[model samples]
Target: MAKRIVLFMFMTFTSLVLSGCLVAESKYLKKAEEADALGREAATLQEMHRELSAENGTLKAQLSRVKEEAAVLAKEKEKLSADNRELDQVLRSKTDSLSQTVADLRQKVSDLEDENARLKEEIAAAQKAREENVRQVSKTYEDLLDSMKGEIAQGQVTISELKGKLTVNMVDAILFDSGEAEVKQGGMDVLAKMVDILKGVQDKMIRIEGHTDNVRIIGNLARRFPTNWELSAARAINVARYLQSRGIDPAVLAAVANSEYRPVATNDTGEGRAKNRRIEIVLVPRDAP
Candidate 1:
């Protein structure tokens, strides 16, 4: 009996020890399961952190690219502003030039208009003076024609008006003897009458033109008057001096000698020679120059 009881106690002790070991084993298994679950959760959190870090890097790169593009846009905007200012300045300069050109053109037009007005006034004044001169000359011619009617009818003098010139032609026989430069009594009377009529005309210039027939001077007359030219010149000068002595202004008198060159008719006949030997009084306008 004692041996059996010892064996039973030993068995009971072994069983109790075994039960404690089994319980400890079960707790260890539960702790290991919890640790495994924690490990899985940590791995999941690490994966999420890596994804977030990569997303942050992508966002940083996008921000860098955006900053670069913004810098380029700012530079372009500044350049465009500068170009606009330059263009505005150019436009203003051109506008100023155009305004000046227009002003100059206006001044030129004004000057031309003034010049045109002055020219028109000058033309009108000139025309008026010319008309007055024409009327005065015409009246003088008609008065001369009437005054010398008797001499004209006798063929001793001829009065003619042409192109504003008045000419009184007197035959040499009525004024002087043959081959003589001195005036006869009849010539003196004719010259005195002409002087009386001519004294009234202050505006016209009087010219005495002496003409000679184509006859050579001879004898004592040749000594007094060498050639026809000398005889004609002496005759014209004497006539002009007589006119001056008879109240005619010397300023209005001119003496000319035409020797045998100017002839009114053929000098081959005696009657034609008589016609060619004559004294001519010419009335010319004062403004003939």
Candidate 2:
């Protein structure tokens, strides 16, 4: 609207200048009034020009403020973009760390499960071994008890079963005469029967242990025997040799002596002393050694 007014005023001023050139004398009749009117119009034009100039200045100032605000907004947008990029990087790093932690925890749980399974298998194997050992021992004890029934009833032998071992307890009088290390004929018969049963048992160890009463040797018997320890050892060795000669495996046999140290009865009485002098044939697992 301001531009149109300015253009209209400029065209009117040009027309007035041209008319003055052509009709300088034709306007003589109301020249004063006309001149006065022209003066008023010029004054109005000047006022409008001043007002337009002031408004142009105000618009210039407003344009400068708008440019400054736009520059500031551009800088703020750049800052926000940079902050978003940094936040994205941080979030990605945190996600990777959490994923790695989860993987490690899963591996730990797997290892623990594997270990638990291994322990269970070991426990099962141990239980099986114990059961097998018990079965073997029970079978050996039953055979010994059945075969030695007559001797047991006559008080010559006793059979005992405990743990994983079988023990056949025989009185010294059943194997040897007084002051003798050689086994009697009756003892050989008993040993022959025992050997028949033992040869069938392949996974057992046989040990012959001899025990003697605390009695000092005297006379020719003393010269032949020497000491109680020697007598006891000789008796055990003799029993082991006899068993080996009777087809019992020598690899499964061992001999040992206990001179008055492992007595089953008191030496204060004759009956007790006789009971204390004894022999033990032990059957144990082959792995027991």
Whole-model lDDT per candidate: 0.87, 0.89
- Candidate 1 residue-wise lDDT, 50-91, digit = tens: 999999999999999999999999999999999999999998
Candidate 1's TM-score: 0.62
Model 1 stretches astray by more than 4 angstroms: 1-112, 287-289
List runs of model 2 lying over 4 Å from the truth: 1-112
Cα-based lDDT at residue 17, candidate 1:
95
Cα misplacement distance, residue 245 of candidate 1 (Å): 0.8
On lDDT, the candidate that comes out on top is: 2
Error of 1 at 35 (Å): 31
Pairs of colliding residues, candidate 2: none
lDDT of 2 by residue, 1-289 (tens): 9999999998988889888866866667469789899999999999999999999999999999998999899999899999999999998999999899999999999999999899999989978977887886787778878888999999999998888778999999999988899999988988877888888775788999999999887899888778888888999999999999988889999999888898898999999999989999998877886
Global CA lDDT computed for model 1: 0.87
TM-score against truth, every candidate: 0.62, 0.61
